[model samples]
Target: MNRKTLVLSAVIGLLAPVLAGCGDSDGGSDGGDAIVVGTTDQYAATKDAPAPLDPAAAYDIGTWNILRQTVQTLMQIPRGGGAPVPEAASKCGFTDRENQSYRCTLREGLQFANGDPITAEDVKYSIQRTQDIKAASGVYALMGNVDALETNGDSEIIFHLKSSDATFPYKLSTPVAGIVSSKLYPKNKVRDGFEIDGSGPYTFKADVKDDTIVQATFTRNPNYKGDRNIQNDKVELRSFKDSDSMGKALDSADIDVMTRAMSPQQVQKMLRSPKDGIQLTELPGLEIRFLGFDTDAPAAKEKAVRQAVAYTIDRGDLISKVYDGMAEPLYSIIPSNVATHTNSFFNKYGDRDLAKAESTLSDASINTPVKLTLHYTSDHYGAGTQKEFETLRDQLNSSGLFDVSIKGEEWKNFRPNQIDGDYEVYGMGWFPDFPDPENYIVPFLDADNTLNSPYTNNTLRGQLIPQSRREADRSAATKTFGKIQDIVADDVPVLPLWQGKTYVASHDDIAGVEWAVNSSAELSLWELRRGSSAPAA
Candidate 1:
C-alpha cells in the first residue's frame, strides 16, 4: 500500500481530507445482496499529481485496488501465489531465447464497458501513455527496459526489451500496466477525474469532493470478459479518517469489511476478543518497513555515522514496544522468507553493541553524539509509526552514541521533501512490485529506484540486478542475491527494520476474506461476497 506512492507521492502537496464513510449513499446497496468496505486511504491532488484513478498515472496500491476492479492488465496474478496467467490476453510469452523480446495475443471480442473494442493498439497506447505523461510519480521507471512496443493486426502486441529480463511477465501483472481504451484516455496526459474505461470484472463510478474521491461504487461489468468470477452485484468502497472510525463502522455494520490501515493496538484487541459477529483473518504478508538514508546529506554522508546508527539501535524493540509484538524483526532488506536471505545486518552489527558503535565513530575521527533528524510520514504507515520513530530516537539517544531528533509529517509534504533530499534519514514501507526477491533489492539500489535517495551501488544496480533478472528460473539466482545482500549490509545505505503481517477484519457473514488478497499485497475485491444475510442497518 505504501510502496506504490513511494515514487509518485512526492508531488502530493496536502493530505486530502480523511475518508468520509458512506454517510447516506447506501440508498439500497446495503442489503443482504450488496457489500460495503472501509479503508483509511485518501487521495489528494496538487498542481503536480495526476488524477488518482488513471491506471497510467496511479502508482498507489489503494488506487490500484480500485482500478483492478475495472481495469484489466494483459496478465494477472492468480488468487494465490504462482506465475502470472493471462487475463486480457489469450496467450503470452517470450518469443526469443534471450528473454529480450515478448509477444501476446489478445482475447478476441474484449470490449470496454462503453462497448469499444479493445484492440492491440489500445494496449500499446495505455502503456505508452504512462511514459508519455512522464509524471514524476508514474511507473515509467518500471518500463525502463522496453525498447519498443509493436502491434500486429488487432489481436497481437509485442514488446522489445533493451536487455534480457525474465521478470518482464511479472511486470505485466501489475495494474501499472492496466489496459485502457485508446480513444477515451488522453495520449500524453492522465485522465482528469475518477473514471475508468476497461474490460475488467467491474465498472466504476464515484463522487468527488475537493479533488478527492468521497464515495465510490462498483458493479459487475455486463460486458466483462476475463478469468475472474464476479462475486456480488454491487460493492461500495467507503473511506475513513482513522482506524477508530473504521473499527466502529465495522462494529455497527456500517461497513462489512475493514482493511489496509488498522492500528496495531486495535488489531491486538481484536485478536483478544473478536466481538460477536466479526472475524479477523491473518493473511501472509510481504510488507516491510525500514530506514533509508540520504547518503548525500551531511547528517549521514560519512560511512562511520551510518554504521554507528546501525550498531546502536535495536529492531526487536520496535516490534515489542511500538508494534505490540505484531511484526518480525527484519535482519536484511530482503525478508527472511525470501530465498538467499541472510542476516547481513545482524552479522555486521551484532545486536546493538554500544562500545562497537562508539568505537566506529571514534575510529573514523568523527565527533561523539552525532546530530541527526529521523523523519517519518504521519499518515501512510499507520497510527503506531510516530511511536516507532520515537522508540528509535530513544534507543540511539539512550546509547549515548548519537543525538537523535525525530520529525513527523503527513504523506503529502513528507514524500516531496524526502524526494528532494531535505531529510537526512526517513522511514519507508515496501510491498513488492512482484512476488520476487529481486523486487526488494533493485528498487532501492537502482538508478530508477523509487526512494530518490542518493545511495548508489553500481555493482548491485548495473550487474547484480540485471544478472538476477536474466535468470528465467527465479530460484537459481541464490548466489547472486547472497552477494547483493552482503553489499547492502556493508554499505549501510538502508537499515532493515521489520516485516509486517497483514490483518483483515470483516463481518462474520462475509466470505472470501482469505482469498481476497494475494502474496503480492494486491486487494482483489471481486473475490469478496456476502455469504449469509447481513444485519439491516
Candidate 2:
C-alpha cells in the first residue's frame, strides 16, 4: 500500500471565478476586497450528507475541519478552551434532579441558510441520525450513552442517558451532535446536492465543481438569536490541487488564506520571510499520533517484541523533523494539555534507547532477522508523514532490532486496513471530542475499541469507561482515567509519538484568526475582516 491522494482541481477552478465576489451576493466581490481562503481540497457537497457534511464517513481530520467551519452546532468551544458555550442553544444543562436527563433551550427563530427554521425537531433529527447511520458514522460510539431524546414545547430538548454520564453535555458540544433543519433533511436518509441548509455564520453561495467554494455577505441572521464567535460578513474558500500551488497562489494574491497541507519546512521558511505576509496561528491540539502494533500478529504478539520496538523510537527527533517544532513530544496517546496524560511511557522508554531495544529483543530470544511492515495514509496528515514513517523504519532496521517494510494507502482505504488489523503495524491519530480526560482514555483504550485491535489492559475498557462516565463529580472521574493511563503505559499497546500544534496560513488581508481544540479546527468566519488589500510585509 502507498499513500492515497485525492486532488480536486477542477472543482476549485469552477469555484474560483467568484473568489473575489465575497460581497456581491450575486457571486462577484463588491466588498472592495474578498477574503480568499485557501485549503488543500475544494468543497464538494455530496447528496444525503448530514448537517456538518463529511465526505468520507470515516471522520478524516480535513473533512472535520471543513465541517466545523462550514456548519453551526448546538454548542462550541471558544478560543483558549475551557467550558463550551452555547452556539445554537441559549443555555444547555441538566433539568432533572438526578442529572441523568440533559436539556438545552433553543434560540428563538433561528433559521438554516436555506430558510428552514432550526427547531428542536432538527436537533432530534441530527442526534437520531447518527444512530440511524451507525455503520457509516464514525461518531456512533460517542452517542452510545444516549438512551432517549425528546423535545418539549418546541423550545427545550431533553436527553436521557443510559447512565449518569457526566460528560454527556461535552459530547453535545461536538459537531457530530450538530443540529440541522429537519425541513430540508430526511429523517432517515441524507439528502444529496451541492447546496447547504446550515445555520452557520457564513452561507454557502457556490461550489464551482472544483476550483473554489464561494460565500457572500453575511446577513445578520434575524433568528441567529444566539452566541457566535465571529465578526466577518463573508468568506470564500479557494482550493488548490496541492500545497505548492496554494503557496504560490497566496504569494501571487490569488488567495487570501492558506489553511492546511503546507510542509513544515515551508512553514519555517514562511515564518522567516517577513515579506511573505503569511500569518501562522499555532495552538496546542488535543490530537496525539501513535503507532498501533498488531498484537494479533505472531511477530508482534510478545510483550518483549512490542516493548523493544517502542524503545527504538526517537520521539523528539521525529517531532522536530516531521512537525518543525510545531508539535510537542508525546509519551502517551493522550497529549499533555489533556487531563489524564501520564509520562510512564516516557520514563519507561526514555529517549530512543537503542541499547534497551536490543536487550529486550535478545532477552525474548528475538533477533535481527525480524521483519514487519508498517503503514500510513498518503494525504491525511502533514506533508512529511511518509518521510516520518521512513525514518522510523530505518531507525528500527539500524538498531538491528528488526527489518521493517513500509507501505501506505489513501485515507479511504487506510482506515479499513487499520481497523481490520491487516498490517503488522500502523500509525493512527486521535483528536478529542471534548477537552475532557475521559475522552482521551475511553475511545481508543476501551476493550472493544472501535478498531477491535487488541491491547493488553482490557480492564481500562471494561471497567474504567463505565466508572468514569457514572461519576457525578468530574474531578473524581479523573482518578479513573489516570489509573487507565498508568496501566496503558505499562502495557505498551501503542508507541506514543507527538502532539501537534494546529497552524493556519492566511493571506495578510484576513484578520481575527483563531484556533480551536478540536483537531478538526473551526474557522470563526464571522470574526474575520478583510482589508482593502494584502498587508505590506
Candidate 3:
C-alpha cells in the first residue's frame, strides 16, 4: 500500500461506563469471542438477492466487502494504497512484451471450505463464467480486453488480452474477480441462493434480515491459506437505517465498532469532544463526490450552459460550511493524492467567477435564469446531503444567472433513475475498486459507462484511453491522464465537487484500526481484534 496506515493514536478524553457485552460469550479475557459491528442499512438490503452469491454479480461496496473476505482472488489489495500483490496465486504478472498476455501460478494444497481442491481450472472457470454471463452491472466491461484463458496442468494459467491493458492486474484485485469453485457454481446462469463455497479467510455462516435490521455472520475458515489473520472466532455485522441510530447503539455499547455512513455532524462532534470508551480513526481521502449531467437533456446540451453551471458554484464555501472542512475541493475526477491528478477545473474556473459564467451563458444565447433541477439522495450520502444540495441551489440562484430546484430520493430509487437518465443532473459519489488513476478515468469515460449520459467523445473512448492502457510506466502515463482531464474539464459532463476522508469509530479497546482499512478504502473486518483489557459485556 502507498499511503501510511492510520492508527488509534489517542484515546477519548472523556470516560464512559463500560457495559456487559452481548452475543457470543465464549471468553472474557479478550473482550469475548465475538465482535459486533454496525454500518448503514445500505449494506444489508440487496436489490437483487434471490440470485446466488456470484462474485460476478456483486457490484456494490457492501456486497463486495463481504465477498472479498469470503472468496479468494488472484491478487489482493494491500492494507494502505499501492499495487496489488498475489493472493490465491503464488505469483502473477505480464509475460509478453505486448502487455497483452499475463500468467499466474497457484500455490499448491489450496482448498475451499468444503474440501474441494483449488486448481488453475477453477480460476479459468470463474473468469469464463463471469464473462459468459455478460451481466449489465458485472465486471465484464473491465475485463473486455481479455480474449482467452488457458490453464497448464493444475497450477499455471495464462490470460491473453485482445489489446494491451496495464491495469488488468489491478482488476484481478477486486471482489468481482473472486475465484470460486467450479464444482459449486453453474456456468451459464447466476446461482439461485447464497450457498457460497470459497477459498478465502472467512466462511459465510448465516444471513438474516428483518424490518429494521439486516445481519450477517462469518467464521474463520480452517481451510484458508492466506496472509490475513482472523483474530476473532466469529464476526457479526449489523446494519441500521441511519447514523443517528447507529450512534445510539455505539453509546450504549450495543455494537463494538461502527464504520461507514456516519453523518459529518456526528464525526465533527466526536472529533471535538472525544466520547469515553470510543476512538475515531480518520482514514485517507480516497473518495470523490460529484454532480453528473445528462448531456441529452435540453438545457445541458449546450456546452456553455454546462460551463456556466460549473463556474457559478463555490466549492470553498461548500467545504467550509457544508462539509465542516472534512473534505477538500476536488478539481478532477481523480482524488488529489493519486498520481496524474490535475486541477484542471480549478485552473479553468478560478474562485467561482459569476461574471465569467454570465458571459458564457450570454455568448451561447442561453436565456437568463436558466431552469435546472438537481437530484440527490437524502438517505444515501448521509444527513448533510440535503443541506449540500440546498447550498448549491442557493449559490446558483443568488448569482441571478439560474433558477434551481432540488428533489430528493432514496439511494435505491435514485441510482436506477440516474443510470436510466431520468434526472437532468444528479449528485453521485465514487469509491475506487482499485487504487489507480485508470480506475478513476475509465469508468466515466467508457462508452458503456454507468452514467448513461448521451455525451460521447470518441477521441477519449477509442484513442487516448487505449493509448494510456498500453503505457506500463505509470509516471509516463500521466501525460495522457492530463489530456483526459482537460477534455473532461472542458466538456463538463460531470463537475467534481469534493474528495472525502474515511472515518471509523470503534470502542477504545478494539485493536487493529490500522489494518481494518484496506488500500481501496474499504473496511477489512477480518483484521479487527479486541484488546485483553476490554471488559466483557
Candidate 4:
C-alpha cells in the first residue's frame, strides 16, 4: 500500500469544496487565528488526563492526538496519507537489509519549545523510557523488538532489533514513539501533571477543569521546527457528554468542529436534514466493532460454544437495525478495503443458521440455553450501544440455544476489567494505529497483544506474523494473512461483526474538514481553519 496517497474516496464530495477553498485567495489568513473543536466527553483531556504529557505513559488515542500536536516523532504520517516521512529527524531509514538495524539523523540545531537542545541522546532516552517505565497501558509492544539503542553523536541514533520487522518505520510514526527532552524528564521516573516541553507544532498551555469535565487549550509553538503549518494560533478542545449535545454545540456554533463518537443515527439525521450552518464530512470506514470471547471462561472455553454464538449472530439485522446501513458486515479482522481481507467467517458460517448452531452444540455434548453475559461500554462506543447489545442479546436468546444477558460499563472501568478478563464475552471496537493488515492481525493474536484474552495459537502468532513482517513486498505476504484469517475463523476467539464509517461535523465555514481525518481515522486538529467568509462570533 502506498501510505502517502490520500484515501478519501468515500468523501470526495465533502472534500472537493474544502480543498478548493484552501487555495481561494479570498479565504482568510490561512486559518491561523483561533478555532474551537468539540469532542465527546470520553475524549476530553480532563476525563482521562495523562499527567506531565509523558509520551511513554500516554496510550489512549485521545491523549495521543494531543501529543501528536506537541511532540515530534522520528517520522509522521502526513495529513492526507502516504509513507511515514521524517519529522524531527533530517532523515531515517533501515541501515541493514535484514530490517534489524534502524538509524536516524536529527536535524541540526533542533530545540524544544523551551529552547533546550534536542539531540540523539533525547531520542534514545525517549524510546528507552517506554521500556523502563513498564506502565500497564503504555505502548512498549511497538518497541519490543529493540535489542539495543546506540547513539553515534548529537545528531545520529541507531536501533538494533531482536527480530527483523519491516513495519518498524510505521511504528515510529505513532505518537507512542514521540521523542522527549532528556533534560526535562527524569531518567528513572515518569513526570506527573500537565507540564510538557517538546519540539512540535503546538505547545501545552492549560488544562481547564470543571468538576468531571476538562477542556485542553494549546497555542502554536513558535520555536518548533517541523513541516505542519499551524492553521490556528490557538486551539480549544471541548468535550460533550453525548452526540446530541455535541450536535447542539456544532449547530449553535459553540464549537467549531466535532470528531468521533457520533452514532450512525446522529450522523444520518444530520445528513438527511443538515442543520442550517453545519457541515458533515463522512470518511472511509476503517473501524471495526466485534465480540471478543475470553477463551479461558468456562462457557467460552469450548470451541463449539463459541462457534454456536458466531453462527447465531445476525450481522445483516445488526447492520440494518442497529447501524441503519452506515456499516457493512465484516467477516474478517481486517477491514474490507484493506489488502489480504477475506470473508472467512462468512464463508464458514453462511448466514445465521440456528439449526446448524444447534447441531454443533449437540455434537459437542454441550447443554442448550448456554448462559453468557455480553459487556460493552455505554459512553465510549457512542449512542445505540445499549440498543446494539440488546439486539445481539435478542438474536442469541431467540435461537433458543442460548440465554444472554447484557451489561454496560463506563469506559474508564470497562477497559481495565476487559483487559483483566472480567467478562465472558464482550463488545470491543478498534481504530487502526496505522493502515496495515498487520495492525489488525498482530494486536489481536500476538502473545502479548492489546486484547488480554486467553486465546493463543503458536503457528499464527509465532510464525505467520513474523514471516509476513519480514516480507518487504506486501503483496507477497497475502498468503500468510489468508492463512491467519482461516485459523481465526476456526478458533472463534473473537467474532468479527461490522466495520463503521467515520463522520466529522463542523461549522459550515470550517475549511479543512476534508483534511481533518487522516487515513488512520485520527482527527488532525492542526488542519482546521475558519474560512475567510465564515461569520464572526
Off by over 4 Å in 2: 1-33, 41-58, 96-98, 189-195, 205-223, 362-368, 447-456, 471-473, 515-520, 531-537
Alpha carbon lDDT at 148, candidate 2? 91
Cα lDDT tens digits, model 1, 1-537, are 101011111111111111111111111124345688888877666555647778776776678788888889899776555677899998999999999999999998999998889899988988888877765563676777888999999999999999899888878987778888777888887887777878888888887788777668888888888888777777888877778998888877888888878899988888776566666666546788999998998879899998998898888777899887468889899887666678999989987899999999999999878899999998777788899999999999998778999999877678767777788899998887776777787778887677776788889887998898788877678788889999999888999899987777777667666667544456788877676333221
- lDDT of candidate model 2 versus the reference: 0.64
Q: Provide TM-scores for the models.
A: 0.91, 0.83, 0.90, 0.91
In the range 247-301, model 2's lDDT, one tens digit per residue, is 7777776776667667777677766663434555554455678888778898888
> Per-residue lDDT of 163-237 in model 3, one digit per residue for the tens?
898888888988767888777788987775555679888898546544122776778888888766667667777
- Name the lDDT of candidate 4: 0.77
Top candidate by lDDT = 1
Better of 1 and 2 by TM-score: 1
For all candidates, the clash counts are: 1, 30, 5, 8
Q: Alpha carbon lDDT of residue 253, candidate 2?
A: 69
Residue range 1-537, candidate 4, lDDT tens digits: 001123443221011111322231221112235688877745322323344257776665666777888888888876666567888988999988899999999888888998888889889999998888755553677788888999998999999999888888888988768888877877767676666678887887655564333577778887788777667677877777888888777666677777767878777787677565556666667789899999999989999999999899999998888888578899999888777888999999978999999999999999999999999998877787899999999999999999999999987778778888889999988877776688888778886677767799989977998998887667778899999999999999889999987777666567666776654457666777666443221
Off by over 4 Å in 4: 1-33, 41-53, 206-213, 532-537
Task: List the global CA lDDT of all models.
Answer: 0.78, 0.64, 0.77, 0.77
- Between candidates 1 and 2, the one scoring higher on lDDT is 1
